[model samples]
Structure formats: structure tokens, C-alpha cells
Target: MAFEHPYGSYNVQGSLNEWFRVNVTGNGIPAWMPSAFIHYDFPETGLISGHSGHAFSLTHQGADPIQQYQGRIVGDGQRGTLMESTLEVNCWLSREKAGGAYTHRLRHMGDMVSYIFQSARDVPLTNVYGSTTDPENVTALIRIKPANEQPVLPDPNPDIVRRRFLIDYRWLERVSAG
Candidate 1:
């Protein structure tokens, strides 16, 4: 029931969860891993924290296909096609960044938080489909949301302190099955 975390050696004491199997793709690639790395491109008062593969989980907010009306009617009286899908990314960040490993973790957290707030660019999320071993990359472009504050979470390990950042990402279009 142990899942890998990008911070090195630490694993969340539970499985990757079942939702990933049904709603997600990528041979069990940890849902928390960012599709790719985005360097800091915005103004910030704090020191630049580097990046790493942080832990996160993705879940759908509503039905598989959430739709909205375009407010314009087509000739066929079709008012709705498809509404973009919303994904809730539960990301983990460490509040305490003093320890040796945590110091590196701090930088990773900063990079993510900064990107979330000033997300001028779309973050690409890649998942492996079919098998974890022979996984093929399936990509989806999504929006990163801003967090008002950091909320503390219970750390399974006695040494590390964990915080949860609930991130919202929406795909403007359906992910292509390329």
C-alpha cells in the first residue's frame, strides 16, 4: 500500500488510489508527478526554490464530461457541446524546510506555488496508459490554480511535516487519444 514520492525515499503509506485506474492513465505513474517542469518566470520576494517531482493526486470534480451551454443556439438547436473538465489535484508541500532533504523540498514547493499563482502558461500533464512498465505518454494541457494559504497535513513519517495544496486544473478541450 506504499506509493512513491518524488522527494526521495519517502512514500505515502497508502496505495495510489483506485480513481487513478479508472479516470487516469499512465502505467500507475504517481498522480502527484507534474506532467513536466516549469521554471520560475514571475516576480517573487522569496528565494528561488528549485523543482522536483512532488506528490499529488487527481480527481474529477463532477461527471466524466461536464458540459455548459455556449449561450448561442446552433441551427440544429444544439446549445451545448462539452464543458471543459475540472480536475482537483491534491498536492503535498512540506511546511518545514529546515532539514537536509526538506531544504531541497522547499525549493520544489516554491517553484510549484509560484507557478500555480502566476500560471501564465499551461502545464502539460502526461500519464501512462495500459501498463506501468510499458507505459505510453498521454498528455493533457491544464490550468493551475492559486491557493490562498497553506494547510497543514498529518505526516506519516515522524521526521517530515506535510502541507496540502488543493490545486484546480481544467482542460479546455478533451484530451486527444494520440
Candidate 2:
């Protein structure tokens, strides 16, 4: 019998770009809110550089009057902590349904980690700080929007002080374009 390499040959060249379909859920998110997507452009050196680099863009595709809403991502190392587990990409979204711009963070903590840590599904009870970026995983958290402009429906109760939500990121299969 002839010997053969178990991990023979495969193509592994070019930039590491990816796309994700993010779903926003929670009482905090108004029912009228639309779905969002994130396009991550890996740096020349690839995923490693992307961790500390600014390379994300946002877009929305849904039925609504909102127009020309665009977003950009910037590296937010200052906002991150030493214990951070996911890559932190700060995103600024424009022209939300309620009529204004908003900022959020795309925690690029790989899929399994996000699920295990519940980073997007649940808010930490004890404020664990730190951040990191994964090669191909993500979750979203919206913050900094004023209490009045938060992505929530008009509430009847005056005592309600805060809103909660879960923004999840799912990897979209990549397709080659001619």
C-alpha cells in the first residue's frame, strides 16, 4: 500500500470575509423592528488582525419606509477589559424605525462560546468585563441610546426604567460570485 498524507491538499488563500444574519429579539425590541446583517472584512493578514481592526458594515433588508440606513464598525479596545472573551466591534446604525441613529456593539465571540456564555441571550448579572474577536462568530448588544430613544414601543407604565433584549448572530453560508 502507498502512504498518503491524512491532511492532503486544499485551497487556503485570499482574504477571510464573512456575512451574518442577526436576529433581534426581546421585549425591548419593538415588533416593527427589522432584521439586520453584518459584513466582516478580514484584514490582509486575516482573522488575527481583524480582532483589533475596524472591518464591519451593516445593512437591513425588510419592508419599511426607512431609507439610506448605513452603519460602520470601529475597534473599541478602550471599552473592552482584560477578561473580554470576544472581539468587540462598535457599530453605529442610522435611521432606525423610531427615526434616529443608534450605536451597538458586535461581540464577535464564536458561536459555541456565545451559546455557552449566553452573551447575547442573557445579560450578565455581575458585570463581567473584557472583550475579544472571533474569526467567524458574532452577537450584538445595543447600548448608549438615550432612554427616550431606545428601541422600545411606547409604554403605558411610567415606572418602567429599563428594557432587555437578545440580539443573536448566525453565520451565513458563503457563495462564490462570478
Candidate 3:
């Protein structure tokens, strides 16, 4: 079975290697505090590629320092304008009990980005869901159109527009007493 998790996209014009960063925060059964960074590379004639680094810290009601995970993104751009791309993230935790990597695909369109995350391994859980510690591999499809197509006038200093996107995960795992 599969589920859908959607996060909006942004429209900006720059080299593929430009550093992009986002911060995500949320509240629910288990609160989430995660920060993600995307570093795009210069546009190549054939493909536009980038890398992502993520750090997530989760806190629950009764759990101590719920869980923490970190990973990276490996993706390839299918369009000249970086319209669509696929990503794989290698994740790990401090506890070491729950640690794994996930691979996802990310697509960029105009002003919206969608992410689809899948599990790298199979588990007994009824439905596989991403967690702060064990984040499911995610593929995000984002739509982006530049605000202005024309080049800006020459100036000593230029005002650049920066956009950000955030992802939140919530779920609980039953502790096994064996």
C-alpha cells in the first residue's frame, strides 16, 4: 500500500549549485523539528544535479529525546530548468537501534513541489511511514516558474529572492520487549 505526502514548491532562478536551505516545525502526537539544506550545482547542458543534507530531531510526550536522524540527497535533473529529479538519502541515528537509508524522487514544476518517500527495507508494520529517526525514502515533485524571465539591470548590489520548503513526519512505534 502507498500514501501521499505533499509539500509545496518554489520558483527561483540561479545556478544549480546555489545553496538552498529550509526549516520545518510542527505539532502533533509527536512534535517534529527538522532542518534541510539543498545545494544545487551549475546547470549543465545535459542535466542539472544537486545534493541535500537533512537533520531532524523528534520529541514525544513520554519518550526521552524521541529520535534523531540525518541524511543526504542524491538526485538528477531531467529537465533543463531542473523541473524533475530523483533523490536517495542515507540516514542514521544516535541510538543505532533504528537506522536505515531511503531513496526518493523529487520533481520541480512551477511553484509547487511534491515528495514521495518509500522504504528501503521491508518491516512488519501494517503501513510503512517515515519517522524522524527512520524517515521513509521520499520523492518530491515540485513546480517552479521564475518570477521574471528578463535579466535584472546591472547594479552593485542585487536583491535575490530566496524560498524555502518544510516537511513534517509523525508516527509511533510499539516498543518490543523481547
Best by TM-score: 1
* Candidate 2: 10-residue stretch with minimal lDDT: 7-16
The 0-to-1 C-alpha lDDT of every candidate, in the order given, reads 0.36, 0.23, 0.22
Model 2, position 69, has a per-residue lDDT of: 17
lDDT of 2 by residue, 1-178 (tens): 5442111110000001111222222223322233322343333442212222222332221112212212211233112111111222222222222232122222222221223224333221111111113221123321111111124553344322212222322211111221
Q: What C-alpha root-mean-square deviation, in Å, does candidate 1 show against the real structure? A: 13.7
Backbone clash count for every predicted candidate, in the order shown: 7, 6, 28
- Rank list by lDDT: 1, 2, 3
Instruction: Report per-prediction Cα RMSD to one decimal.
Output: 13.7, 20.1, 21.9
Candidate 3 per-residue C-alpha lDDT over 1-178 given as tens digits, one digit per residue, 9 for 90 to 100 = 5442222111111111111122111111111112232223322232211222222211111212233322211223121211232221212122121113211211121122222222111111221133323333333322222222122233232211122332222222222222
lDDT at position 134, candidate 1: 40
Q: TM-scores of all models? A: 0.36, 0.21, 0.18
